[model samples]
Target: MKSILTILVFLVTFGSAFSQTGEDKHPLLTDRFIIGAGWYFPTRDIKVEVAGDIEGLEDIDFDETLGLSQGDNTFNFVFFWRFSKNKFWSVRGESFSVGSTRNVILDEEIEWEDITYPVGGEAEVSFGVALYRVFFGRVISSGQKHELGGGLGIHGLNVKASVEGEGFVGDTSAGFERSETEAFLPLPNIGFWYTWAPTDKWAFSANLDWFGIKIDNISGGLWNVSPGVTYQIIRNLGVNLNYEFMNFNADIDGTDFRGSFDLTFSGPSIRVMGNF
Candidate 1:
């Protein structure tokens, strides 16, 4: 937590250290408010390790151990607002979700949350994550057609994992429906962005967001990066295409569960944008 705080202080003051703004800017940067709704196509690689009242569990690969889809199409939304006091200062928010459920025959002995499912039995397995991010930032430097800035933010996650199969119930064989665990992780992060407009109708941008630290009962890192271009359809509207990569790794000791997981999502995206 101490390491995270040290970074918090550094990123919060990032703007004042080298704040600069360009008089000439693109419509996307100068807009007071912008909203976007997009679709993302990404491949996922997930591995989970968990135990209840037990330890030394092995990692379970979602794709190899269980038959879950390795790719998905999902919706993402974004909003940004530049403060009236300083166009160089702004706050942005983003949200997205990815997950799936599948039923398959168990290939090896499985133990999760005190329940055991022997090989050859059928099981239903599911995993999903919903993400939210909000950041406050400033433009540290700018030129006629470009701007650069860094900021601090929080990456909030809602993670759920579950496996259901027949297991012993107090020494008696019984059929079970569901056994699942959910965790909420709110982590702090630091991010930087660059935007350039070569013409009034076309603009290019790239953003990098990352953080790694141990906070209380949770420990690990998060990374999100996107680079794309925008084409203005009209004065108040546009379209954007970007390739984004996101990964999250964490170990948790929480009220509902204790476990660790690593999830990766990366792919291309297309969005419709409104600028004002």
Candidate 2:
């Protein structure tokens, strides 16, 4: 699948390099509003450990320990709005969801909260994450074929993890044991974006965001990189091919969860865009 996407992108770039439309600028550079939707294929490495009052707990490597898939695909949506009178400012938003579930026999004893999942028990583990982001930016520099800007943004994340299986607690066996934990993290970030149009119909763009901050009882850091290409199929519609990379780590001392999570998700995405 990756090879196919690579070929597609190469073909688009090859065709656009030699083709030129009469228009002097790309439509995406001038559109007041742009909306896009697509699918995302990601490779994930997620590590988690919950620190409870009970003392002894082990860090879990989701893919290695639980047999979860390292690669998966999901739907994605993005929106852009240039709202100022002179079109020098804009706001952008994007969203996506990631999740995986697996059933495997435990190789070693695992303690989660008050329940102990013993070795040789078939356990079901599932993890899910939902991300929502919005940004406000101003174009500091621009030309007929390029635009550069930076802005402040916020990321809203809701993550949940669960384990269910036959387990034991304090020498007492529970035919069925289940433990689940969920957390909501709101992280603020700053980002920059750049776009270069080689022709009226083809453009190359990239966006980067990063931040390290402590808010309330949550200490977290985040960074994201996205580089893509766009082809204007028509005056009001286009298509996008992009590769996204994200890394986020956080520590919590709250009532819901008292542990840490370090996650990395990277993938390629293709979307359809409409302008207004």
Please report the candidate that would top TM-score against the real structure: 2
Query: CA shift at 230, candidate 2, in angstroms?
Result: 0.7
The per-prediction tally of clashing pairs is: 0, 0
Query: What would the TM-score be for candidate 2 when compared with the true structure?
Result: 0.90
Name the runs in model 2 displaced over 4 angstroms: 1-20, 54-56
**Could you tell me the lDDT of residue 256 within candidate 1?**
76
Question: Residue by residue across 147-218, what tens digits does model 2's lDDT show?
Answer: 999999998888888889997876899779788889989889999999998788899999999999987888
lDDT of 1: 0.86
Q: What tens-digit string does per-residue lDDT give for candidate 1 at 57-100?
A: 68778877988887779999999999857688999999999899
Which residue pairs come into collision in candidate 2? none
Give Cα distance to truth, residue 87, candidate 1, Å.
0.6
The per-model lDDT (C-alpha) reads 0.86, 0.89
Residue 79 in model 1: shift from native, Å? 0.3
Per-residue lDDT for 91 in model 2? 96
